[model samples]
Target: MAVNVFASATEAGDTAVPLGGSGVAATVDCPDLSERLTTVPEQARPDVDTELARLDEQIAAAYRQLQEAARTADDAKLDEGAILDPLKKERAGTIERIAAVIGKAGKRPEGLDTLAECTLRRTEVATTDAPGGSPDQQRQQQNGKGEEPGNTGNTGNTGDDGDDGQTGDGQQPGNGGQAGNGPVAADYADINSVRPNVVQAPRQKNASTGSFATSCGVNAEGLFNSDNLIAAPGVSNGAHHFHDYVGNQANDAFSSDEDLAAAGTSCADQGDKSSYYWPVLRLQNGTVEQDAESPGGGIEGNAGEIVTPAEVTLRFEGNERGEVTEMPRLLRIITGDAKAFVNGDTNANASWSCTGFEDRQLKDKYPLCPSGSDVVRTFTFQSCWDGRNIDSANHRTHVAFAAADGTCPDGFRAIPRLVQRVVYDVDAPSLQDGGRTVPLFAVDSFPEQLHKPVTDHSDFINVFDEDLMREMADCINSGRECGPDTPPGSEPGQGENPQEQPTENPTKDPQEQPTENPDASDPPAERTATASAPAVPGQDGRDDGESEGKGGGSGAGRNDGQASAPPAQERDDDASPRAEPRAATTPADDTPDDASGAAPAPGATQGTGGGEDAAAGSATEPQATRGGLAETGSGLGLWPAAAGGVLFAGGCVLLIRSRRRSM
Candidate 1:
């Protein structure tokens, strides 16, 4: 099933369609059964997880089949025969297996077979033009008040200029890049033209303002896999898209919690064993990657040269409303929807922008940065955690997002939020020539996702030991900025500049530290000097010699016209590892909670908001404690509940005063 990495064209009825053109394409859309399994019994969790992953595999296979079908193919015939009907049967059997497992433990989920039937969803062809001009300019042009900007023209360039599909030697240009799959010319927009829509979340007086940065090299080790240990444990190729891993190295579909606990990390501080990974970004130039024949690669419609990030900054920031609690070890979290294209964007959380234009974020379109400006991908993870479970049956219920006002829901506690920023040095693709001049770049995604920018996402599994976790919490609560290069357990401003007083672990391996400099023997932890702004080359805090390419295997030596990522930039609201406390206007928390712990109906939005605000009580009390009181008071008589509330508030105040004095 390995696709020709350089496929120049796909059949389209009687005519032979040339490669790299835009038009409506059909994709498979099925109900997300995972979101509906809210309360699987603990004993059946493993079997249930495996079956859910099978559902994804079934859909992926159907999508690949759809790709083989020509555009002019009959939908009715295909649905009942070649595609939909077969997919439905497979899905039904899988659903039955899932139900059987749950039935062994508790009440079996019913009517899941009804979700087997899926349909082809038509996707609109994306625009490839780099639209320019300010929002004001756009408004004026719409009213015939002004002329459209020059960059705005030629947007309809179908990528089929005069060049023949075949090059002189009979090889397809760039090895049939773009693969007629996606990332059409319209998927990219000019960053300068985007209006500044980033709004920082308003911080309350009790906000935890401190920040901690982890210095995990930009995945220089090149650890990659298609398995999603969190979502699809024990299932191979569960993700069907390669993920570049940076923190914990012992991760795979079959990895156990014990394995992760004992594994090594790429992080400068070994104490932080958290795994941070996201889909790999590939250049659509015809060069075939090593994974071209693998399940997550060309076989899955993801082709081209894999690009290693020039800069990766993993920073943990404090809550805006109050102090953050330590994330329990092994707590699993997934941010952004990997299947957002078909999932309807209910959980899309990643943003795209350019290095210098971080203020302007794009949820759907990729940015066409000016020559010197590199493309940037930013992921802001959920910061609120339920005090109980490390993971829920649906994998989403244990965590939630803070409200627009920056308060965690009534029952969820605020935890340090992880903000990941990845940068790539790449030349803008030539939309006029359909990426023939400069190939397009896209993030790896499910075959059906069409490599859409909206589907970009990241994953995290917290593995910080208790001592390190407590230190992180204390640092944030005390308003101290700390980082991997900072001295272990150092106070504010003490190790801000590692160049001044360096901390060294004598027993650590020299190879553990990845540096841009080949000759320099120092590990990344010893060189905590501030790097220049991202706009400047060698911004990764290393000298020119240290800014060499980080990609290995097939990705190496492919830099003829490619750009290297500009190194580390100083921390800032937009460019640094520290996440800005910004109000998310995307209505990320609008989903309602399911009733009586039952899963929501298929296709219904899952609740992402922290539960309703805790009943009125001492502001400093634990969110869970306050929530419990609120629920209890609802059942008592009015007079008794009032008296209890007053007494509880007084007791909380007294307890807080006593604790503060002790401190």
Candidate 2:
């Protein structure tokens, strides 16, 4: 029997097919191949081969089952009692521990895992290499684990464990760690550690000259001592103490040049500083008046040019009408030109040549006039003269001086003229005020022999008029006579009426209403009618009832009450009046008529109505009482009562309807 076996093409092609020889007969084609097989183990080797193939199939099925189990375990969702649960938990714990270690390290530590492995390997090596060590040594070698020498892997060397309880370099992780470090100190020690370059800052140059000696001889603390420094003359110390410069100079030298340059640039960018120069006008009279001018074509002595003072005269005049008119007054004299002298050579002997000429004809001739005289009186007078307009044509009238009234002689009058002349010299010190030069010079020297004695008068003489003084005294007396009793009009008490007894009736008397009806429902209306009544009750309670009678009783009271009631009814009937007038009259609106049909009893109604009318006449009647309760009840009056009731009831119905709709 021919057995058929499946084989690769290469093997199949290589299989030998025996050809039938001469002695063998050709066999028929076998259709039932299994029926032709040999039944013995040697004839068919199917058991061993089949058994091997079955085993291979079993192994493949087991591997597939194992793979399916792995996939299920890895699934995000799993049954509660799955066997992989503990293993999954252990894996997750390991991952979390690894993350925690990485987080604590901040940055990954290089070769950390390799170092740990090397350390464990070294421990293993130690355990194997050092067998007979002490218990401690053995424990150390084993790394606290009782494992075989070659089994354990390396763990890294001990390092600082961070705040997160993981091994890393010294610092803790995150912002919390930085805050926990606390504030850095600002002292030299701390600052040097952070910025060592700061200690290398150059020292500032000393600009002080030490003068004061301290207990330490010369205080080495000259940095803060202002007395140790000599400042240039004329330089301001800025304040009483000059020590402030020490700090300022130190800052200037130590601060960055960029900062100083920035400040300087800012200042320079602000442009020129504002200043003021007052216009000065030099006057020949020695008075520094504003806008005064020098005379043209006159004896010129450098009036406007800067020159040294040779001689100057100062004149003082007194108010002739005052008690001090006789006193010799000290005066200040100034001059524009300081180069022209009176005697040409007497610079030191200069004196007032016209001083005591008060008694001579010179006094009467040129009393107030300084021109055509040998010497001029010097005096300062504020003038609105302009220096640009002064010339020889205006010289005589340019300089003027003061004198006694009517002291001018026959044909003379006070006129302005040159007084003291100045002689210039470059060797002399320039005239200055404060620290600035005066810019103008005064003449030097004068003729001393020309001086004379000035007339003197008694200093105690009263120069004022006595009659004028008496008139002033009378005015003061008259002012003092005015008292609280004085009336506004010229006629003291006559213009004002005297206090009088209050009459039985005042002319502008308040109209009184008649007695109201005890049964009136609306007493306010009744009272109003009574107030308008023509007749009123008399003192005797008699009712004359006459139209002309001022007072009456019975009939008058009835008429007054009747008359008062209609106007009130008319007021109540008017709808528009009730709306605005009621609001104006009664703020609280608590009146009986304000409520719907809520009238008081007969007598109570009249009383209440009268009281309300009076309150309405005055200020502050209650209006709120009228509108508030009117919705719930009928009102007392005609139109207003009905209208208010309707409005209130309508408002209530609307509110109810709205509530129903909301519900």
The candidate scoring highest on TM-score is 1
Which parts of model 1 are misplaced by more than 4 Å? 1-24, 71-80, 126-175, 488-663
CA lDDT, every model vs. true structure: 0.59, 0.17
Model 1 lDDT on a 0 to 1 scale: 0.59
Q: State candidate 1's TM-score.
A: 0.68
lDDT tens digits, residues 414-520, model 1? 89877776778776665444455567788999888878887898999999888888888887776666665445554443211111211122232222222232222
What is the per-residue lDDT of model 2 for residues 1-663, given as tens digits with 9 covering 90 to 100? 012211222233422211111100111110111111212132122232232222222222222222234233332122322222332343334333333444454432232222111000000001113221112223344475452332221111110111121112322111111011100010001000110000000101210100000010111122221111111111221011111111112212123323322331101111111010001112122332211132110111112222212222111111111111111111111221111111111111111111111101111011110111112222122111222222112122222222212122233332211111111111111111100111111221011100111110000001112332232222222211111122222121110010111111133111121122222122111000010111111100000010011110111122121112211321222222112111000001121222221111111000001111221221111122224444423444466867889999999999999999999
Error of 2 at 410 (Å): 4.5
